[model samples]
Structures are given as C-alpha cells and as structure tokens.
Target: MQSSSSLFPVALISAERRGDLSEDVYRLKPGNSPDGTVELAVTRLGLAEVAESRGVPVILLHGSFSNRRFWYSPKGLGLGAYLARQGFDVWIPEMRGHGLSRRNRDYAKNRVADYARYDLPAIAAFVREQSGQIPHWIGHSLGGTTLAAALGGQYLGAPAVASVALFGCQVSRTYWPLKIPPVEWGGRFILKRFAQLSGARLKRGPEDEPIGLALESMRWHGLFGRFGDGERDWWKGLAEVDVPLLAVSAAGDRQDPDWACRKLLEQVGSEHRQYLCLGRRQGFSGDFGHVEMLVSKAAQVEVWPLVERWLKDPLTPVTGAQPEVLAVG
Candidate 1:
C-alpha cells in the first residue's frame, strides 16, 4: 500500500511537464448538451496517484447549492484526499445551478427534478465511461436524495450502483412537517401568490464560493431550521435500492433529525444495512454537523475509518469476527 501523499507528486509532475492542469486543481469547463452547452465545474483529486494504484473508483455527490470544492477545503473535510491516498479513484461533481455547473448562455432555467433526471444520470454515465466500472456512491443531504431518486428507477438506463452511503436523508411524509392546506381554505391562493412573488427559481448562494453555496442551500431548504417540512415523497424511492447501505447521521444535525435517518434504515427495505450515530454520547457537542462530517478537519480521523472498513469488507457472507468501533467523540 502507498502513502496518501505519495499519489500526488507523480501526477503533479506529469501535468506540469505536459502543461496540463493537474487533477488536484479545480476548473469550470463546458458540458455538451443536445440543445447547446452548460458550464460544469469540478474539483479533481487523487487522479494519477490513485489510478496508478488500481484503486476502486468513487464518485462524490455534493448537497444542494454546493459544488465540488467542498471536499477540498481544510474545513471541507479530507475524505476525497484520504480516499485517494487509500488507492481509490475519486470524482467530485458540481450539480447544475450550483457551483460551476450553470446553464448555457441561452438557457438559464434550473429545475430540481432536472438535476435528478439529467445531471446525476449523466454523471453516472461519465464515471462508467471513464472508469469502466460502477463506482461506489456517497452523498449527503440533497445529493443523497438525488442519488436515491436515481437508484429508485427515476432515470433511464441507470448504472449499476455497487453500494451506497448516505448522510441526512429522510423518506416518510411524517419526516416532513410541511403540507399543503385545503385549496378551498385559500391556502392554494396564498401559495400561488408567494410563488409568483418569489419566482420558481433555484436559490443562489450568498457568493460563488463553495462553502457559501453550501450554507445558502442549507438555509433555503430549511435544513438550518428555517423552512417547514421537506417533500415526503422525495424519500419513497429508497425502498427500491437493493445495494448495501451505510447510513450515518449527526446527533446534532437539526436539519435532518437523527430520527429521520433511523427511519430511513428501518424502512429502506435493504437487507444489508448499517446505521451510525455521531456525537450521540457527547450530548451532541462534537463538530460533526450536517455538512462538517465531510468537510471538517476531524472527519478524516473520525469518520473515514468506518467508511473504509465497510468498503473493504467482503461482499460475501460473514466469515470472520466483526471490527471493533473506535470512539472519536
């Protein structure tokens, strides 16, 4: 096995020699579409180093209002770099309307459903075409929801997702506290008026910065305790996912409460499932917030080990003793 830091030098040197932007660098590039083109930005890491080691490929999906850079920041967590050092190919995608993925000059419409139906599926296809294998799927928040939707038969010719790991996603309508009131009671008129005034547009981040986008998105979705209930049917698709699931939750995450994650496991309908609660024993004083789990400094030492152990375990029936858990909080 090679050290994580060893994976980058060669690639960096090669890129410099060839005048090519290294994978560890971030860039906003144009994406092809039947109608025109879209500017899709992404942060590539552990390309030459991990690929040289013949590691398993992993694709990371960012939450709403976030871009790929979320995984590269010091506070953004070290999962991508750590996994790359662990010999896994990692690709972080910026979904449309967020980060670097923006619509063509002529078409600026941003639809949430379109992200599920188009952006995610295209990313999956791109991964398969590039790696010739189905990469492991990991997501958080809206990203997790979108991935679940893709696996639930929402997309055409969906790739075979090997395994799935989700953080902060819910299914039941009960998990969502918002509901439409009776139209006869004038609720519909109020909603219509509100929509008109607000416009059916995707919320923009406070700035073009990745973390800013993340914060803004969380705020818009009421994940920070601002909005009412989320869409109940959004999680119904999880029932169709048959892959092994590693569902992690933050005890302090007020956005997607721990109860929602627990319910997701109980009703996910997957035979192979594991649930992890972070900061439970500490009275929720840990740094494992909704987004911090993937971006915080402590995440590498605290969270990645569990993920690695699960991924490295054999897919076959149990044959050995279970691994012991390490208390991080």
Candidate 2:
C-alpha cells in the first residue's frame, strides 16, 4: 500500500512510553476546506508497541466538549487503555480546537459537516496508512453523529470503515420550540452572539464547543430540518450504508432517547446490525445515562465486554439467548 503520509504532510508531534503503553501522537495539516479556511490542528493517537499486530484496528471518537482523553486518561484509566491491553490497535483523534488540536481559522464556524467531510477522512487515511487496515469506528454523542453524517453522505465509504458502533447518537429527537420560526430564529440570534460555549462554565466537559455546532444542530432539528450536508441528504442516504453497525442507547439518556437512537439504527441499510439499550428494565444494574454509559465504572465491566464481542463478530443474532446481549438490550 502507498504511504498516505507522503500525500499529506503529517508531523510526529510527540512520542512517549508510559509503562505498558506506547503513546505516539501525530499532527496532520489537511490545509484549507472548500471555504478557504485553514484547519490548524488534527491530532491522532496511536498505541502500538503493546498492541497486537494481528488484532483489528479501532478508532475511538470522543463526544463534544471532549478530546482523546475521553478514551484514555493520563492515569491510563480509560477504554482505550483497556483495549490496548487486550491487544487492539487504538487510534484516537482530537478534532480541531480540542485538546492538543489548536484552534483553526474557521474554528468559530466549525460544524459537524466540516468534521465528517474533512477531519474524519483525514484521520481515517492516516490510520489506514499507518496500520494498513480498515478500522472499526466507535463514536459517542456528537462524535457518533459525525460518523453517521460521514457514512450517510458517503464521504467516508466502505474503503475507509470496517464497521461502526454508535453510543448515545440520534437525529430524530424533536426540538418542538425550535420548530417555531420565531423561536428558532431567536435561539440562533442568541447563539450567534457568542463565539463559543465554555465547557468549564457549562460543566459540559473539559473543552469548549464552537457556537457553530449549536447553530448547525438547531438548523437540522428545526422545522425544515434534515440530517445532511450542503451536498447530500444524510438522513435519507443512511439507507445506502452497507457496513456493519452496533447502535447502543442509554435508556436514562433523555438527551438522546432509546427510541430515537433505535430509529437511526433502523434507517441503516446494513444487514449486519444490532441494537442494545441499557436500562434496568433490560436487566442492566441501572439505567445508564449519556456519559455514564461509557465513562462510569459499571460500563467498564458490563459494556466493554459487549463492545469487544461486537467488534469481533457483529453478525451474531440477538435471539435473547445470550446473557450479555440480553443485559445490553
């Protein structure tokens, strides 16, 4: 295979050995988008030394107001660490303006469409170039929604994705007030007043989110909303996606409810697809919330194993025969 790094200038920003984990951080400059705005930073994580060369490659995408640290903490107490120890090649990328990624020229205007069309393909190319494999993508919240947009738009096709697993991702959730023109316009007016939202102040997460994200979301969920980019209809395009899929929804997540999540999953054309809802009714110890479903200690034990199983084999039928599937259901 040709080296993708040669096609795009990718700088090795840093490399560190932390006990059992070898962290290789890289920065790729994909230059400017179609709008003539340059993206300064697109950073990716590679945990390779301890990774099993024979194991499948996996990329973990953090939610909004987050970075690669959501998958791997400094203390090595994250899902990325757990996967690396179990022999998977884990690649985590911090979107532009998040974590080590510096704010770009279009930082204030950055939206999910930009991420799906530019950032993700860049990350996928670099990861494939390095690992020589199509990676399984795992994303949370906005990260998952971006993945959906990429697949739905056919921006990142089967050549780039081996499979996808979405956590707390949905597009069907109705914002009734936003459906009202006056209300929608009013909300947009207020959001445009601010350049960005403070993650620390809002207690959303560690990093801030651009107002552009909020703006685009409002447009999508508003009255004349449809999930897609300026080029294609993402929501409608989802029916064409043929890759394997694992859609996980947290029942306690009022943010992105189970029904909506399942609706997104049902829209996908993939024959190899599974849906798992985490709640007490499903026999899970408790109803997992948006973040807690993945970040909490309970997820470490219950959810991680199911993810592993899905990665290994996504076609397994959920005949309600398996304990893990039942619990995850």
Candidate 3:
C-alpha cells in the first residue's frame, strides 16, 4: 500500500486495472522544499498488457477548483486515459490542498508562485526519477499559468523537460479595474473575508479554491503588478525560455481569450513553438469554452491526436483537415 523512493519520498497508494490499462496512485512528499512539507497525489496510467513497457511520461495538470479528475475520470476516461492508450505513461498531479492532496499548513496561503517554484518542480523531478526519462508537461488554465511561471522562473530547467504544452493558459490579460487603488483595496478586503471560494456555489467546479488564489490574482492584476514575486520577473524571464512549446486557446474561451494565449506563446523564447486556436474557423466542430476545450467528446476525436503528435515530436507539423494547428517555429 506504501513505498518510498531513494531520494524523493514517494508512497504508493493503490494500483488497479481498467480494462487493459494499469492505473497507479502515489503521493510525493516534498520535504526539501522551503515551503514546508506537503504531500501531492500523482496518478500514473499505462498499458497493462505490455511487460516492462511503461511508456514515456507526460504530466497533465489540472486547472483551478479541480484535481487529477480533470485529466482522468473514475470510468477510466479523459485525456490521461487516451494518452495511456497511445503508448504514453500519463501522469496527473493534484495541486496542494486539492483532491487526494490534503490541505497543507499553508493551504489557504498558497499562491501560484508557490506552486510554480516548488510543487511543479517536485512533481517533475519525481516523474523523471521514476520514468528514467525527461517528461513532457501539459497544463490547463491555472495549471498552464503555473507551468508558464515555472518555466519563466527557471525552476524547471530545459534539461529536465522534453517539451511543454499549455491549454487555455495566459498571464497577459489586463483587468483595468484592478489598477485602481480603491478597487484594489476593496477587492483585497472582500477576498480576505473568505478563506476559500466555493466552487459549486460559483458553478466553476466541485472543489473549493483557497482564497489565496483570488488574492494572488488580485495582486497580479493590480496596479504596476507583474507576473513574478519579489525575487524574479517571470514576464521578462520568459524571453529566455527555450523549450519546445505549444500553446492552445479556444475561440469561445473568454476567461483566457485566444489573443492573450497567442501573446503568451509569443513571449516564450522557444525556437520550436506553436500556437493553436480551436474553433470552427480552425476546423474544430464549434467554439470551445474554457472547460469544453479539453473535456468534450469532440476534443477526443480532433485534439488528442495533435497532443500525441506534439509529445512524440514537437516539431512535426500537424497534417489533418479536422484540426488546423498553426505552427510557429
């Protein structure tokens, strides 16, 4: 039921089979992190029929108010399962205080900075250590923002990652109201009143988000605010990130619009980069909303193949009529 790795403390939770696929859950304790010891639950899925054939690792990150369920469901459905079927060892990590990862000592105080600088690197290191290969990363919404921050801050080096893909991720969206002093103070006051935001009440999802996330966003969009903490400027640091990167934005995603997503892709200094807008114009069935972008049945048919292709070879131009991918190498 439990075990530990040599360097990174990893405890296996359970291992079972779904049809012909193998699913394993493990908890990673990042005791070395300055942020304090917080355990993270990670799920690994692969072929059960193949012997000694754990496919290459690909980490799928969930957005706000979500968990590993965002990428995988109990019925063994979702992108994580799709990749497993495609010969990929898929990994899904639940952020601190989310899903199987219990609330840490500073759960309510956690921020994207903490997630980017510490949790992500810990998860990546564990994945790499276990797989014996560099892993590709894909994050959606807040997950993508965290991945971007991690890359921009140089927390996860290029050597440790094979490639990176972000879905519905951006940080350049400016809310002019947050720039006003009165509004900023008022917003902070209102946010500070609540320890956590109810996801079900807000109709966002099932998991509640720590109010720290809202406060962090408030600061990021505040007057003269940048996407970094006191120690680094993530926006400027992005100019030096040189990994194979792919950014996908949905046309109907007003939360993080396509234009902003494109801008984030432009900010990355990767020579091998790509930008994709999913909509009818781009050969998708319909304009995908923030959540539908990755979770819909259409996405399984049109988008999953492209994801597989990117993981397999980031530079390969997508050749298909159903999904039009814009390559920006």
Candidate 4:
C-alpha cells in the first residue's frame, strides 16, 4: 500500500562515504499538488550502512527557512547522525524548495496545506517502501506544525506513523495584527508581493521560505480564522489522532512558549501523550531557546537521550526524577 504512491521515481542524487557516516541523498519529483502546477521536490537523506539489527526507521523534518542540515550537519555532527550511530535508519527530508529539494512550478504559491496533503504522504510512502515498517516522525517548529496538520487533517494516519515527537511547535501563536481585518488584509497584501523570504536576508536560517507559507499562516491567524484548509478543519480533527505523541517545549523559546505547545498536545486524543518542557524551572541545566533546544550542545547531552528513550518506548511514560527536565507524562 505504501509503495502505491511512488508516483515519482526517486533518483539517487548523491552518495558519499564520510568517515563513519554514510550519506545517500535521493530526490523525488512527485508530480504536483491539487493546485495543478505545483510540482514538488522532496529530498531524502538515507544512511547507507546496513544496521547491525535493522533498527526502527526514523524521519526527521526540518523547520521553516531550514534544510536537511538541521538534522545532520555536513560534518556528521547532528541528531540524525547521532541516531544513525545508534542504529536507527535515519531519513531526513527537505521540504519543497528547501535544500536539494528545488522549487516547483507554483513555488511562489506553495503552502503548508500542500506539504501536509502531498509532500508528507509521499515521504511516508517512500519511507515505508524502503524500511518495511511504520516510521517514527520527529518534527521541529514549522515542521512539527505541518506534521500536526497532516495528522489532524487525516492526510497521514495510523500504520503510517508509529509515533511522533514534536519540538517547539504550536499553532496558537497569536499575531495581534492579523486579528484585525484591515491589518490582516494589509499584511497579506504586502507579503504577497514577495516570491519568497530569504533566510540569509532574515538571518533566521540557511534556506528561503515561500511567500505562500506566509499567506497561509496569515489566513489561519486572520480574524474569523481557523486552523485548516478549505476542505478540513485540522484544529477540530486533532482530537481524532490517537498515537504516541511527545510534544516538547522550551521555556526560553519566545517563538513558541510551553503553554501553547502543551495546548497542542492537550488537544490530541492520544491516550499515551507526554509533554516535556525544557527549562531551569523544570530542573534542566538551563532554559533553552527554540532552535537551541534541538541543535545546541546541551540538547545533545540532555534532550537527545530523552528523545531516543521516547522513540524506543513512546507508550511508556518517562516517570520518576532525572537529571534532565521534568516531563508531564
């Protein structure tokens, strides 16, 4: 069933053996989205070494204005690399127009809706085809939001996702200006003029983000807005998702506060869901920012192990005190 959607052939774009880290990059030109002209460039990072015991497949989705490097640095020193060393079949996917994934016909109009409905399912199908198992998903920031949208919209369902770990993600972030009709329309008017937002220009990250994402977000936060596309109500649909969920938040993340992240977790209907907050108040070494919570050295020491533990046994809540932060199981 997973292989059915292998509509576009995956081309092995690059294969390089870098020390202990084996990298095989693939590119999938998956036709197009509902908006006829919007083709997709979905790139995957597959670790080549045959695992000692065929570990579980894990897919890491990078956030907005970012690329596959968010999970695995070029020097083989990121969470994805660490997981590969630990015997996990790690697959890092660069979303449309990010990294090796080139822009499509409707590049300027690309939105999260397209990502949730088309790109993710295609990635899942391809991963399931190769791994022969339901893959665990780890998404950060906007990546997590897209994951939630996919789950909530029922575009990606059980037997496709073994478990999900969301880091620094929430849809409830209030944009005060968008609450007003004039401001909302005005902002959209201004944003639509740009084809894409440059990461280098913004100094936010390495990759550029399509203006469609900005427009989509504006619609979501606009007055009388809701969290879903025209077809589905993702906010309402979230209650139907019943998988092992781990929503992680950082106290110092002004971008996505713990309360909002927890709110997203709370809406899920998962019987086995855990909320982990990283902060000094929670006994963590220090308060973590949005990006640092996953990429920083402290995260590698403290949070990465916790993430591994969760992926290994998501149903088993992390109980008792630990040297790390306290998690609401």
Best by TM-score: 3
lDDT (Cα, tens digit) per residue for candidate 2, span 240-295: 99998889999899999999999999999987888889888786889999998898
What ranges in model 1 sit over 4 Å off?
1-36, 47-53, 74-77, 104-109, 154-159, 171-177, 180-236, 282-287, 314-329
Q: Which pairs of residues collide in candidate 3?
A: none
Q: Poorest 10 consecutive residues of model 1 by lDDT?
A: 9-18
Shift of residue 279 alpha carbon in model 3, Å: 0.7
The candidate that achieves the highest lDDT relative to the unseen native structure: 3
- In candidate 4, clashing pairs total 0
- lDDT score at residue 252, model 3, on the 0-100 scale: 95
How does each model score on TM-score?
0.67, 0.92, 0.97, 0.93
Query: Per-candidate RMSD vs. true structure?
Result: 9.0, 3.0, 1.4, 2.8
lDDT of 3: 0.88
Put down candidate 4 lDDT per residue, 121-238, tens digits, no spaces: 9888888887788999999999999999999999988879999999999999898888999999888889988999999999999899999999999999988898999999999999
Rank candidates, lDDT, best first.
Answer: 3, 4, 2, 1
Cα lDDT listed for each candidate: 0.54, 0.83, 0.88, 0.84
Clashes of each: 5, 0, 0, 0
Instruction: Pick the winner on TM-score between candidates 2 and 3.
Output: 3
The deviation in Å at residue 152 for candidate 1 is 2.1
